[model samples]
Target: MSKTHFPLPVRQLAVFLSLLFSGYLLSCTASEAQSDTPPLNPNGDSELALLMRAMFDDAQAMKQQIKEGKTPRPSLDYEKILTAEATEPDKAASDTYKVHALSYLQTIKALQQADAAQAASLYENMVNSCMGCHKALCPGPTMRIKKLY
Candidate 1:
């Protein structure tokens, strides 16, 4: 056929494959950059650990409100817990734990601000932080954290 060109569909497929491969390469590069970072331990019981624990406690209390058929208190004061954790992040088991602890505190605050449906969504994130940390440095409390969900 004297080198007849490929069809338009083949060109589109080639473009799509190229884009997909590029995305995968970028993701792999980003993941590799984070691979050397240390894991978190949310249950270490240091200051950050304590803050994470307190955050979880607050989350549980909110859940209890639902169970008891009561509204969550609007003045739960999540900032206090966050401030305490931020003030001394180095005391946490790891930097990742400190970061996640702070994030969990904010999530609790958001839950308080959100409607019941939104609050329920935040609950999953709270549990995820616990599981993420426990999977690395401290698996001891992972079971209890799972129960919270």
Candidate 2:
């Protein structure tokens, strides 16, 4: 058998370099694993986000009540939508957004005033209101809001 040989000092140096390179690679991987995730907002979600989440819940309940032919007196003060501060304050300040918010509120009010016989359509209108506003302003929730139908 033939053996490849290196001088003792050269072999030790190669071994030392291999160990050092392995340690560097391991440290790099560890650092990558510890990379920071998104930081939570210190002040928490905007009032508008919170309000919308509540509205979504109320709508879900109302939808169920509607299916059962029961009147849904959703207690959520949807008017708060106008005054609530949004996550992106600039978007809330726009004229287009104001109109959308008013449109959404009107749909909710209509849904509330309608009889059970008219509720399915009114509820559909309400969902459409959300869809329209979200589609124009924030498309992120559009898919989720579609499930309301």
Q: Which ten residues in a row have the lowest lDDT in candidate 2?
A: 36-45
Q: Write the per-residue lDDT of candidate 2 for residues 68-108, one digit (tens) a residue.
A: 99987677989898899998899998998999989988888
lDDT per residue for candidate 1 within 74-146, as digits (tens), equals 3445555445543235534467766765776666566567766566666677677667756755676787687
Q: What lDDT does each candidate get?
A: 0.64, 0.87
User: What 10-residue stretch in candidate 1 is worst by lDDT?
Assistant: 84-93
Q: Stretches of candidate 1 above 4 Å error?
A: 1-53, 74-93
* Candidate 2 runs further than 4 Å off: 1-43
Clash pairs (backbone) in predicted model 1:
none
Winner by TM-score: 2
Please report how far candidate 1 places residue 73 from its true position, in Å. 3.8
